[model samples]
Target chain A: MDATPQMTCQTAREAFPEFLDFRTAPTARMAERSHLAVCPDCQREFATLTRIATALDEAPSALPSGRMRQRFYAMLEEEKHSARSIHLAAEREHHARGLSLWRRLGLPLAGCALLAAGFVGGTRFSARSPESQDHSDPEARRQLADLQQRVNAMGQLVGYSLIQQRHSPTVDRLQGVLTSASRENPPPQVINELISALALDPSAHVRLSALDGLAAHLEQEVVRAGVLACLAREENPLVQVSMIDLLATARDASARPAIEKLSTNVTTDRNVRDAARRALAQL
Target chain B: MLAVRDGELNALGELFERHHGRLYGFLLKLTGDRSTAEDLTQTVFQRMLKYRHTYRDQGNFAAWMYHLARRCTADHVRRSSAAPRPIDPADLNLHADDAPHAAGQASVHDDHRLLYAALALLDRDDREVLLLSRFQELSFAEIAGILECSVGAAKVRAHRALRELRDAFFRLQRPTPPVS
Candidate 1:
């Protein structure tokens, strides 16, 4: 009953590796023939392997049905559309996040600039006597301060402009307030007007609240020519500041003189005039 | 015909025309129920289109299909809810045609019925491996993917299934003793 009696005829398991692949290795084929010649047990195993390979070779391939094909194609198209919609939604969310971050950091600087603009743009403020101006209604000034604070935190002013456009704020009302005081000059009105409208506005610079809107208007040729013809003779430092901003991007032949006047140390303070001179040269 | 792969309905219809009768015959032998086997074979190809991406060119395509058939057969046993199921036979046939010269076997109607019953008694896993290898003759490696097991495991399971078949055959041949 000992199974050891059958061990002598047991085939080497080595034929297995070759049998895994249907292709017979030459050595395996020779080995298989030799093993089968002497070993009945191995012959059965070999025969079984061969039988399996042949049967599988005879087995049929799977084929899909008509209705199922239609469903799959529809699903793939739907997936592609969904992917694009998801991508666009994600892009807008990212842009919104950047605007939010700017508002978080720009508020304090905006407050200081609001004060600086009201006083006027230069060191000439320190030289002024305290009694020179009339006491004004503080309400409008306060509103301006608050807006300046909001704009400061807004990061890049370009995005704030986009926000303003989205909100549809009253540019005409703001221009009206500046125009009423234009004969004398309103420092904050002029600069804010130039920032919001003249520089980037569709209107002419000559149409600005003051000659200072000239610099912003210069970004466009019609505005540039209007600003030069109307404000090139104005000596106001506030007006000159806009001129500098205008010259910053100007290639015009007429913008050179205003730029040079701002640069001369004799007319402007050393630093302001020095910066203006460099800007003029660059232009 | 629906092609679940890429919605190629025409291709699937063509494939069905080429393969249905041949596959139906094989399944008929495998299940011993002409109608059930035909339905199951149709469903298998429909499901094939569903999982066409799983097919790889590395092995014989037919072997892959048989691996699927093995799974489907095992599933049919496990569910046991398939309506119109064929009645159990006293024995089952493993092969529908002539046996190898070594066995000098001739398959007749009696042998075929016994073969079917003997096959039904096998555990689903062992039954699949045996049918795929011994009946369908798929290589062990292709069977491994369908079963998600190693090739060595497939071989051992196949060998075990064969031994079970041999035992079942022996049992059917024994005469039961009469009660006192």
Candidate 2:
């Protein structure tokens, strides 16, 4: 006699779902199987349930359109871009606050230092020996001029150091620097800094401001080269459009080939492509 | 998903690629409208990105995703002016592209049609349980997590739903008596 108890039809039917599952224990499945073999009613019910499960399992999943993938990637890109922009904006705000504190305190301290330097220098020159102080002594006059130049250089160094301390300068700071640097016949070093920012700043706002700062110097070879290189690598459509417009405004015909390539590239943003085409025509 | 939560958002694309097909299918069966299903599928992923910080590392990603999918479906139903109704058989799109090519091909196709119609006729809760259990192939514990029920309850619900589906399928399979 079998040691295992026989499963009643009610018990076997109740466990049909488990019985159909391959994960069910062999002994339990065998008990259900023995019941089904003896009871035709349960057998038919089990067969019908089995068929239903198979039909559902074999059902083909509908294929979504290719447009869905395109939409998904576009959304992901937008999210990533927004996340980066938010992070950069926060950094910019922090840097701006730090600079505001510096302006509140550092400017007055710098002014005081300049006045102290002038007072000390004047007192020392007056206290010098009569021969050295003689107004007709050419060597003495040259020394005084050297002293004045050194004091001026020291003031400029203080300002430059303050600007250099910020690792990630905000748009406001960059704009302020560019504004001060935009003097008549701006220094060569200033021009180089502006060009570098235009070429590499991650923020489009900063790059656009840098481009504007370089506008007056577009006639220079280095400035033109930097803008052209920026055009080649720019991925943001807004920045690309602005750079194209700047090149067009400058009438830099040498940029025609790069603009032409951008106009023809399929992956370029539509607005950027249109702007590039317009720039090429202008060139 | 942890990668997503930790700000390596690109990891989400990998998750989407791995699961979107089954998810879309699950929604398609749930809504019975392709366009609605597609829209809801997109919404589900968007919610995942939005609420990724809420996901626990030890939890199953599929369960988390289906939980979101269920909320999206519910929201969609509430937004519509009309109450939910049985899906039209035509909208079910029960084409059996994978059915084996043999002398029984027609019979298999007929069976698919009948099963889908029965699925369409099932109550919303019943249909959901069947889709989660049989189609998505999710374990009962995971279904419980998504449905906010106990594992035993999930199993009981699935068994009841399957029985109803079987009865509906056979009812449809029986030929009608000719009018006198």
Candidate 3:
């Protein structure tokens, strides 16, 4: 950091940043300042550099608009909420699956125990009431059904919310649809959400997955009609082919027009047209 | 940032609020486009979150953030290399109409505008080195870390960039002879 009598202009210029910003130690700054005092060329160079730095410091730049901030926070919130919901859904699914197994076996066992107790009591009391036993048993079954319904409703809500997210990654949206569709008895509303995704999702892969989801629920007349309609409007050949396959698998007569249209359209991919023709034959 | 690494997402928001203005300014100077600057600023924070685990407690956060910023800009350049254009001062969003102070702030002498124009002509790496040192006000050590080079090399690069900038300024100052 020492300044020598022979300090060249090149060496002096090296400290431009430190000198410009006063980052140099006091002793070094003094020596550099003295060198600039003596060297005219280096002094002029330093002046121009100062002006440039000053102008740069004052250079105008735009602040991010409120819309940008809103977009960022919206994205962040979606990520946070999605992460929490996914975690909760995984836990709930695990617990509910376990509970469902228990209900399958436990309900019968409990019923047998209650009947056995009723038969034993009947022997002791000649006027034991049959209506009392039937009443409590049906109530217990109804309670289990209610709990199951509530769990399904929660899954449907989470799935619907996730599918509706505008900025979510394709994989995440597809995952939500798949998770809901994988349930043994998904609600009709959940099926409708998947159908919407199948018809409207920007990503072909997402649409194809949505078609896969709706394929399993084709027994529902609404789901069948939705998938058939999606096939006619689907722009992606892969998704269109998949939709045709789904309809063909369901033996849906409503899909015949869509399949015939694709079959006759020369602009369609050769594979897609052939698939559609095959689907029409199946229907 | 440490809290963010430990799964406290709200901490990330605090960091964003504190650093976003400077981050956006740096990006605007680098890309010379407001929209790109905004996009890169968001990408920088998103990267901070995604790679938060890699952050060392003893590391300089500013250098780390700029490293990500450099990468983001590099990616953007690569994606749009086919249509590179010179940055126009007019493209700079000075908010002159909205803020009275901005009118004076955005106005610079002819030489200063020439300096900026020359700056745009330098190599991308040279522009980056100079901007990181001068505008960002980072020490050579921090600049070296962001550039992944030695401190001496960073200083040398900055000096060369300054030298080129001065030469460009002088070249721009030369008046063309009256067109015959």
Candidate 4:
């Protein structure tokens, strides 16, 4: 239509989308441009549209803070966990439906035979000394313990993944995971997750819970360094104070440099600075 | 997003990290409220989970997501009793703290403020059209799909919206007639 004089102001305006944005073909833009070149009203209108579009593109958009990310991840993790449980329940029902009654009965019968064999073996072994029992071998006990720890570590990893979800993890759920981590001979990975929570979890209380759970492990070099780094970067005064106290109680002299920095940091809260000073003296 | 649909929840976190900033920016501009935008960002992800089953594998995920975002804005408007108030100067000056090192920037900042004020005065539908077309940069077909209209109709609405926005902008800039 470059040759046609029939392109009306109305038609030009109707093609405003194509005119305002270059979403149209070059030929369409040529026609629109030719029309605008001859038409003042359409040209003025296009100029106004261009002005507004340019201003908006240059306008600064306010970004949501870390809190929003924390909340979204928490919600996602909860939903996933709920969905997984539902799937698991469905699978259990399917298994029940597929199993024959004879097969179901055979499982319990096998369990009884295993229990009876274990009882007979125990009696025969104990008739000699307890040390003579093959089941009492240190290697066997250690292997069983290692297996149990691995199983527990696997479970904790799942929990850790849920907590790691940047969306808002529930404080109680994290606390539950922390409590499990605090039990006898906690896995190293579980400890690592706790250290990470201390350093980076958005919620102050969650960080504090991590501190409480990890208190027993502070003697470990990595745990000490993580807590110190957390103290250095923590904006929350309460968490900082708690970290200081944990470090002092652990008698970690390595934390002295971080404590000195925080103590002398004029930007830090008065209470936090004072706490850091106290920690420095104690350490 | 495919991973999210397939029950890999952690994958959603990656998606959010990649997109939440832009998504939040869109919502912030639309609602003109930071907190509300944040709440709606969270709501969008929650809805993604709630409606994951409906996600068609072959569909455009961006289109589906923006459609959800559009619905979220509409739902929020419906739930609120009050109309969207004019954009606050303080809110519009989101980048005021940025040290404007150049002489030309002050005028640009003023222009930005004027445009936002003008945008706030437009009808919600008009603003939606302009935002989707300009800021969010959606194609007319995608806008049509989100708005539930034909492509021609979407174009018309966009044209009308742009006209109204231009009118409002000039009206704001047209200095108050010297007080009698």
DockQ of each: 0.02, 0.25, 0.34, 0.33
Give candidate 3's TM-score: 0.56
- Candidate 3 lDDT, B76-124, residue by residue in tens: 9999872323456555555655332435534444544676678777888
Best by TM-score: 2
How do the candidates rank by lDDT, highest first? 2, 4, 3, 1
A142: Cα error in model 3, Å: 45
Query: B57-103 in candidate 1: lDDT tens per residue?
Result: 57665666666666676677567754332223322222433333435
Deviating ranges (above 4 Å) for candidate 3: A1-5, A29-32, A93-283, B82-87, B95-112
* Global CA lDDT computed for model 1: 0.52
Sort the candidates on DockQ, descending order.
3, 4, 2, 1
lDDT of 2 by residue, A1-283 (tens): 2223666777777777776665667776677677777787888888988888877878656777777878888888999999999999999889987986687347747776877788688768777767776867898688678876665544444433333334545744464445534554655766766766777666677677778878888889888888999888888899889889989988998899999999999999999999998888888
Please give the lDDT score at residue A250 for candidate 4.
86
| Count of residue pairs whose backbone atoms collide, per candidate | 24, 0, 0, 6
What 10-residue stretch in candidate 1 chain B is worst by lDDT? B85-94
Residues A27-119 of candidate 3 have per-residue lDDT tens digits of 775656778777888878889888767766665555777777887787678767876898899999788867754654455456556655765
On the 0 to 100 scale, the lDDT of residue A165 in model 4 is 49
- Evaluate model 3 with DockQ and give the value: 0.34
**Which ranges of candidate 1 are over 4 A from the true structure?**
A1-283, B1-7, B25-32, B52-59, B70-78, B81-107, B135-137, B177-180
Say which docking band candidate 4 falls in. acceptable
